[model samples]
Structure formats: structure tokens, C-alpha cells
Target: MKPQSMLFTIYGEYVRHYGGEIWVGSLTRLMGEFGLSEQAVRAAISRMLKQGWLVSRKVGNRGYYAMSPRGQKRLDEAAARIYRQDSQVWNGTWCMVSYNIPEERRQLRDQLRKELSWMGFGMLSTSTWISPNDLADRVREITVTYEITDYVEIFNCQHLGWSHPGDLVEKCWNIDEMNQAYQEFIEIYRPQYEDILQKIQNGQEIPDNYCFVEKTKLVHEYRKFLFIDPDFPKELLPDVWLAADADQLFQDYYTLLNPCANRFFDSVYEPCPLVEANEVNS
Candidate 1:
């Protein structure tokens, strides 16, 4: 993971619990586990501050940073997608966005396409994108941001028994590719998991630094799915959906590693009023 993205990972996963703030000294120390230099970490912080994702506060001689309102909103929206357990009810409907941008505005068109994909909309055609979840708010945000509301249209739609959900899944996404990614995640993390299990079985203790690094890397790797997969409902997926298995493994190992990881975080900074290690089971 890039050192800059690691800033968000640390804040969203850990520091947010401690009043959504962190000191530069503490951040530099935590980032060392990933082999990031103190200078590099500070540079990333500077960039984040300039980008308006972070705000600084002074306490005596030291400065502490926290997410700006804009940054918090971005993280909150991402959390909704990343940590969501698939909804229990899909309602047999789809949300679609179709745009017909002028050829001369190719840059705007490309940007719109990227934003729609990030919002979990799968490309149904060159100009049409669809998702099982309601994306009205996200679509509105993109249209307003790009000033292209007039060129785009959003629809709430249903299949009407004409096309198969499974076939649509295949057409809109590369299930084979995603399954391979899931398999790779299993291969990489499963060994780390077995080592943890072996330590437990032998009544051996795990090092805090090891736990911290392993958990962070695992999260960074698994989060790649958010960009690659639309995470469609089960009814719209192939019978052997590996994402479910991957998610199960993530939850199981994440919980197993939590105490050690939390122990590491607690050691890096001063005690806080809030919980140091929030449980990830939810």
C-alpha cells in the first residue's frame, strides 16, 4: 500500500476511535512498522493537509492532526461500502445511470465513467451503468460536481423475466478474475492465520509488531476488491461465489488478530478516553 493511503487506513481503522485524531510523533512511529521513513510519513501528512483531508491543532509545542469534515465524509461513505455485510433484501430491482456525453468532452466522459464505477455501478454498455444498490445520491453528487446533470439520466429498473441475473453478472463483470483474486487472498492470509493458530496451540505469544503489520497488510490487500468487484447480490452471482468465503476468512482472521493488533496500537500512543481496539465482528 502507498504510504498516503496508509494514512487513511490507520485513521479509519484505529485512530478514529481515539477522538478521530493523532499526533505526528505517534503517526511516524506507527508507520515504521510498514518500513516507511519518518520523513516520508511527514511528507504524506503535509500533502493530506494541503488537500484539505486533514486539519491540525496545537497543544503546547506539538501539533496533532484530525480529519477535516470533508475527509470524514469521504471515509464514512467508503466505510459504508467496505464494511457492509451484503443487504438481506435486494428487492429484484436495479439502479442505472446512462450518459451520452458530447464527443468533444471526452475527458469529462472518462471522469464520469470512473466515478460511476467507484460508486459500484457496473458498465452495462458504453454509456450505461447499473448496480443492485440505490445509487441516486452518488449519481447526483457526480452530476453536480461535473456540471453534467443535463447529459445524464438515472433509472430504477427491473429485469422483468427477460434476462437472467446470472448471465447479466457474467456480462457486466469478470467473475473469473475476481475469483482468482479471492483465491490469492486465501493463499496469502491463510498461512498467516495458520501461524497464529500454531502459536496459540503451542501456548506461544505473538509479538505486537508482527500482529500490527500482518493485520494492516491483510486489510490493504482485501480492500482492493472494492475497486475491482461491484459486490453484487448472491442471486446475481455465480453459484460458487468465492467472495463469501474470502469475507468469512477475513472476519475470522481479523477477529483473531484484533487483540494483538490493538496491543500494538496502545503501545504507540498515550492512553485515550475511547476504546483502543474496536471489535471488527460487526
Candidate 2:
């Protein structure tokens, strides 16, 4: 999710839970808890209310808001999209950089710090800053409110304490869910992998060129349009559930993708070569 969307999604979830326009003071408190400002919180809320992402009701000179059905659906869709299999193992050093926090929100900050600490965070150089496990998603929820997206980069330092740079986005899902999803995902990939392995064993190789066609255009098109990043692998594939039923999955992924794949084949078919990164001792 984008930073703004992240901010609203958090607030929207809160409103949905509370079931009313939260008091302005409460909203401000939440903003502070997340190391955000009153102005930023108000603007995000106003934007959400305006976009019909939330519906607001004025009660005693304050507006209480909650997400519409559309907003709920939006969040559900995002959950499905955002929660994917873990790409690799955990490195255990993701940091949260908090800035411009207010003095009065000290209690909230302390509480947040404690929660993160309980979640296995360590004290970094900052007086209040905390370093959690090496996944950026939790830190990103706060960063999202602050309008920081894609601020990720390969970072490693002695003061910061790291062995090598890492990618956090690929490890964002809840660990348990990730483990389950990954097992399922791997199981789904096994047959395809076996088939590919057999082809290689039989001295057959993937063709360098095609007859200007692909198997699954809908999967490809829907992915590119609905998702901004759309960073898919070279070979078009279906989801775990779909791929679980291999033959059916293959057919569906291909049949639904013909016309669209043909249309874009001229432009977007580059084969990706996967490389393994060497382990570094931190």
C-alpha cells in the first residue's frame, strides 16, 4: 500500500472497530502514538471521508467516521495482495525511525516502544528508537502514516548492526501465515518444478522465442492494471489455490490469458535469471 493509503487504512480500521466518529482528541492521540502529527492525521481523515473511503457523522462539534462497504472491500483486497509467501529467511534487524514526536505523547510513545520491545525489538542509538525483527512491515505501518513509501534500500552498518543489506517487503506477512502460505506455495510449485526438471533431464530446454503468444492474458493484465508494481516472474502463473489443482490451474491461467498476452507479448516478455545471494557474517 502507498503511504497515504496505509495511513487511512490504519485509521479506517480503527474507525471500523470503534464504530463511530472518534473524538478529535482521540484521533490526535492515535496520531501521536504512531509518531504522527495532528495536522497529518486530520488531513488523512478528511481525505478518507471525502473519497467516500469513510463515512462521517458530526456529533457535538466533532465528526466520527467509519469505512463504507467499499472501504472494507478495499482493505480485504489489499490483505490478499499484500500477504504472500516469504521469499527467504529472517535476518532480525529491521529498524523503526521515529521523528518529530510531541512531548505530551510521551506515554503513548513509551507504550509503543514497550509493545515493540515485547515483540523482540532492541534499543538502537536513539533515546526512544527501537530495532525490531528484520521485517519492515511493522515499522512501515508507522512510516505509511508519515507518507514514506519505498524508502527501503540495502542498508548495513556497525552502529546500526547488520551483516548485509536485505529486502524487507518480501518478508512482511505475519510469520505464521507466511510459513503456512509458503508451504502451500512450495507444494503448488513442486509439480511445475518437477515437470521443468524432467524436461531438462530429457535434454529439452525452454524456447528462447515464442510464436508471439502466451497462455494466460487475464492473469497478466489484471495483475498489471490492478497492481501498481506488478512485479511478476517471466512465466505467467496462477495463485496457490489455483495451482494446487495443477492441470486445472495451468489451463485456467493460460486460457484466461491468451488475447491479453498476445497483445503485450511484443513489449513485455523478458526472461528473468534468478541468482542466489551469498551469505555474509555480520
Candidate 3:
């Protein structure tokens, strides 16, 4: 895994739980478990700081890092989606976003498109994006974040046209591709899950560090779906969706590994001190 991406996994899976902060030394040591050099970890941290995903503080001679508010918001959203169960019932309303950004602001337009995609919006046309979820508030946040409120408009409406909703869905996303990805995930991890379960049943002692590594890699792999899966509601999904199966497998594997993984993490984690507001500023 790339150092920066690994750091994000560590922060999201481990550091956020223990006061949402970690000493730079502790972070470097944890990164070493994944064969990342201290120099690489430091460089990744610097990049995250520059991108406003991380904030740094100093207490005496030691430096610590924590998620910035923006980062916290993003991670919180991701965690919710990552651990979410099967799709909820859809109300048959589609949230549509239409933008008319000027040619002069092509960069902002491109960024807006990326943001929309990341939020599970699929491009229906050149300037129109749609989702089955109610994302008006999220769209508002994106518009405000990108300073493109004047160029963007959001609507919650039903599709009453010639094409079926399923057809629209097919046009918007590659369901076959996503299903194959889930199948591959199942193929890769189901064996690992079965092996670990057999070992536990056989009274074999799995090392805490081993569990930690397994759990981290498991979550890291599962988290990839956030990029590719739009997580459409049950009403809009294909008849033979594999994402539900993948979700169940992930939950089972994660539950099996969580205790030992947390034990190993707690052994090495060094939480930041709770300083007074004024003291922190100083």
C-alpha cells in the first residue's frame, strides 16, 4: 500500500478511536509493521498536513498529529458507509444535480465532478448527475466547499420517462463490473476467513500482531468499495447483487479479528494529553 493511503487506514481504523491523535514516533512505528520507512511516513504526514487532512501540535519536545475537522467529517462518513448493512428501502426519488460551470473555471468544474462521483452521484449526461439517495444536504456542502453554489442546482424528483429506472441505472454505472469486483473480493478473503475460524475452533493461539495485520488489510481492502460502489438502494440493484455477500463476509471477518487487533494496537498506541484550550494554543 502507498504510505499516505496506509496512514489514512491507520488513522481511520486505529488512531481515531484513541483520542483521535497519535505521537509521530508511535505513528512511524505502526507504519513500520507494513514495511514503510520512517522517512516515508513523515513525508506522507507532511502531505496530509498540506492537504488539510491532518493537524499537528507540539507538547514539549514531542509532536502529535490529529485529523482536522474536514478530515474527521470525511472519515466519519466513510466509516458509516463502510460498516453499513444492506441497502435501505428506496422512496423512488432521485436526487439530481445539474451544473453550468463556465469554461473559465474548468478546473473547479472537474473537481466538482470528482466530488459528485465520490458522493455516489453517477453522471447521467455531460452536466447532469443523479442518485437514488437523498443527497441534497451533501450537494449543498459540496457546492459550498467548491464555491460553486451559483453554478450548481439540486433537485429531488421522480423519473417519469421512457426508460426504466433499471435502464437508467445501467447507463449510469457498470453493475457487471462492480459485481465481478465483489466476486473477486470474496474469492480472495473467504479462504482467509475460513482458515482463521478453523484455527479458533481448533484452540490454536493466533498472535495479536498477526490479527492486527489481518484486520488492517481486511478493512483496507473492503474500503475500496467506497470508490467503485455507488451503494444503490435495494430497489435499484441487480437481481443477483454480490455486494451484500461481500458485506456479510467483511463484517464476519472484522468481528473475528477486532479483539486481537485492538489488543495489539492498544499496546503500542500513545494518546495525546488532554490540555486546556489556552494551553493547547500556547
Candidate 4:
């Protein structure tokens, strides 16, 4: 429960915001806003306890509950794994391709593109794509997993209408450097993340008013969790990244987020290169 201790306001909007202590009275007030009765809130709290997600103590007329050690440990693992989101390297080519995706699968197409951006793939020209990770490998994994073969032919260019990067590592690695700039965020937020792990498991939908602020912080907070090494680099990346296979990494990232959101994009789309930046710079 250490990730987000400084900012109670962060989850205050998500869960019933409580003062240091939570009694039936406090939970009652908070739940009342949601039309939840005190008994209902108490039952939920007890359910959290049975799940080993929280530990509660009694202080006179009130009961105070917080994340149990086990709950905290679970969140810690999630935070660590979040940083290691992608386990592969990028190739020089951005790995852009086009496909005649079925019209009915429109939702899947958009979800695909959005997840790609989250994974750091950038759009070059029109639909032309570029990313630190190898596009060839990503496509291979997707084709095999989804069992669609038509998309296989699109990325293969006769004379390079589109191309990889001079050095994909350099561009993507810069983001890691930017992540290190936020040490304060890590320290303050880890506890909060731990504390919320229990609440997240409570099965209560996020209250409506809490959506914007809470999600923003979660995105940013979770961003911290996804940073493998905030200190990576900005100047130059390893030459080996050019040779790494991206297919598997893409599959893994795709799988990780698939449970949360659907893939999206218009078509197995391709955009003309804005300016095929010089052939794979080292």
C-alpha cells in the first residue's frame, strides 16, 4: 500500500474517500453518495477481509482497515511487472503493413492501433508505422495467433516503399530516460498502488465522478510500473536491437492488454513514408 500514499485524493474519487480511520459511519457517508447502505459497505469490507485483501482493526466504535501484507505484496509484483511490459527489441524498420481487414471487425482494428501506440509504435506517413520493436516479428506472431494469413503479404516491399529505421533503439530508448525524471512519483505512488490492490479486487465499479482523475493517475502511475528502466538512454541504443525479433514481444504485449481493451485500427493499413529516413542508421 505504499505506491500512492501521498495523494489520498487520487483514489478518494475512485473508492469512498476516507479519513485516516474508517468506521461504519465514514463508509456510510461515502456509500450514501452511491446509494450503498452502511450494511452493504460493511459487508463489502468483510468480504475484502475474507479474501485476504485487507486487515481490519477496531477502535472504539469504528473499524479501520488497510491493505494486508499479502495484499501489498501482490501489488508490488504487479508494479514490477508493469515496468517490464515489453521484453523485446526493435528493428530498424518501423514494420508498417496493410491488410484488407474485414469491415465487421472494425472494433478489433482500432483496438490494435491504440494498443500499438501504448506500446510505443508511432505513425509515420498516413498509416505508415514505425516503432522501436521489430514490426516483422510482431506481424508473424499476430498472424499465427489470430490465424489470419492475408496480412502476411502487405509489408513485403519490392524496393522499399516503406522502410525500417536507421536505429530504432535510439528513438524508443529516449522514453526510458524521460521516465527516470520522475523519481518522486515512484516513491509517493507505490504505497497507494498497494493499498488499492485490495479495493480493485472488490468488484465495485469505479464511481462515475472518479473516472477522469483516477484513470489519469492510474495511467501515469501504471506508466511508472511499465518502465523497465527509467535510466535507459537518449543518445544511442544498442546495435543488436536491429536484429531482435519483434513478433513475440508484440504478441506478449498484445496478450497483456487484450484482456482489458479490444484492438482497433481502420485496416491492415499502410501509409506512405513521410520521407523514408536514411536506410537503418547505426
Top candidate, metric lDDT:
3
Worst-scoring 10-residue span by lDDT in model 4 = 262-271
Q: Return the top candidate by TM-score.
A: 3
Between 2 and 3, whose TM-score is larger?
Answer: 3
Q: Write the per-residue lDDT of candidate 4 for residues 137-230, one digit (tens) a residue.
A: 6556555645555543335332243323333434434534443434445445445544444565686444433433333344444444233332
lDDT of 1 by residue, 1-282 (tens): 688899988887788777888878899999998999999999999999997899986655566888988788767877776687766667888998999999988899998988787777888899998888887887887798789988999998887765688888777878899999999999888888888988878999888888888887777787778777777876677877788888888888888888899889988975323333442211
Candidate 2 per-residue C-alpha lDDT over 1-282 given as tens digits, one digit per residue, 9 for 90 to 100: 232454544443334434423455655554454456788877887887676677665543444555667677555544443333333443443455544445665655565554444333434434434333342565555445444333322222223433222222223212334335435544654565466447657987444222122222112222222222221221212233232243234344444333443444333322222224642211
Ranking of all predicted structures according to lDDT, beginning with the best and ending with the worst: 3, 1, 2, 4
Ranking by TM-score, best first? 3, 1, 4, 2
Residue 85, model 3: lDDT of 64
lDDT (C-alpha) at residue 93 in model 4: 30
- lDDT, candidates in the order shown: 0.82, 0.42, 0.90, 0.41
lDDT of 3 by residue, 1-282 (tens): 998888889989999888898999999988888888999999999999999999998886789999999999888988989988656679899999999999999999999888888888888999999989898998899799889999999999999997889889999988898999999999999999999999999999999989998999999988888887878987888788899899999999999999999999998888877776555521
CA lDDT, candidate 1, residue 50: 94
Which regions of candidate 3 are displaced past 4 Å?
274-282
User: What's each prediction's TM-score?
Assistant: 0.87, 0.29, 0.96, 0.31
Cα deviation of 125, candidate 1, in Å: 1.9
Model 2: pairs clashing at backbone N, Cα or C within 3 Å: 21-64, 21-65, 215-254, 216-257, 217-257, 218-257
Question: Which of 3 and 4 is the better model by TM-score?
Answer: 3
